[model samples]
Target: MPMLTDTIKEKLSSIQGLVFTEINNYPCIEVPKEKILEVAKKLRDECEIDQIRDVVGVDRFTKNDRFECIYNLYSHPLKIRIFLRVKLDSKNPEVESLCPVWSGANWMEREVYDMFGIIFLSHTDLRRIYMMDEYQYYPLRKDYPLMGLPGAVQLPKK
Candidate 1:
């Protein structure tokens, strides 16, 4: 629940192209997809952000960058939580996996990939969590119909 300290801010500022901002008073870092792995490593190794609380994907259909990946990170020792966000291209939204830094990220990354169709490069067990493997559409996407596409997924007969 703690806010980012001046020391942590200074450390984060050294990383080129990383924009440090706040949303609702919570520190958020917007990093380029190419630098996400490197920045994540720095955060874990240098900033002591040891855990990723959650991974979320956002569909920005109207924006030029149609996808976004957000990582909620926590520093247990400091009792601080921060957000890392990456914008992705609409045609092929992809980003490097952070499983190497934190093993717990494996499942979280997979969930994002499954729901958003955002490929997590180098994720060992990247697969669907809720939808079946043959499911074609990403239900969470803005373009998806509220009632869902008929025949998109086959349900067991009751």
Candidate 2:
């Protein structure tokens, strides 16, 4: 493990990248879009975060443009944890699949892409999981008004 410095921590924190927090004695880190993969590699190779717990996407349309991809990694040997986040453009959010590093990420990333419209760039098979085959809009987006659309058919009540 490399020597961690306060400067390095502050530098990574100040990059406008990776919102971080210490939860229950774990240091969680978030990385910006451009540094997502780089940070992930570091977490695994340098910091020894070798376990992939989950990958998920959050749709926040209120923001100007993009969804946030959340990655959770754990180090079995070191007993440490990390949280990685990447901001991607909503229109075409994409990232290299982390499956190459952690096979567990494959299906999780795909599910996130399917539901939130985020794309995993190098995923071998990115397909819809829970939703219907032809569903278009991302159901999780804040702006995805699900109640009704203009001129929606008004069904008679019983």
- How much is 134 displaced in model 2, in angstroms? 2.5
Tally clashes: model 2: 2
Clashing residue pairs, backbone N/CA/C < 3 A, model 2: 18-30, 18-31
Candidate 2 global lDDT: 0.70
Model 2 bad stretches (over 4 Å): 1-25, 146-158
For each candidate, what TM-score against the reference? 0.92, 0.74
Report residue 112 deviation for candidate 1 (angstroms): 1.0
CA lDDT, every prediction?
A: 0.88, 0.70
Let me know the TM-score candidate 1 reaches against the reference structure.
Answer: 0.92
Q: In model 1, which residue pairs have backbone atoms overlapping below 3 Å?
A: none
Query: Number of backbone collisions per candidate, in order?
Result: 0, 2
Error of 2 at 96 (Å): 2.3
Stretches of candidate 1 exceeding 4 Å from the true structure: 1-3, 155-158
Mind giving the per-residue lDDT tens digits that candidate 2 earns over 122-155? 7888888886666666667777687835534444
| Residue 141, candidate 1: alpha-carbon lDDT | 90
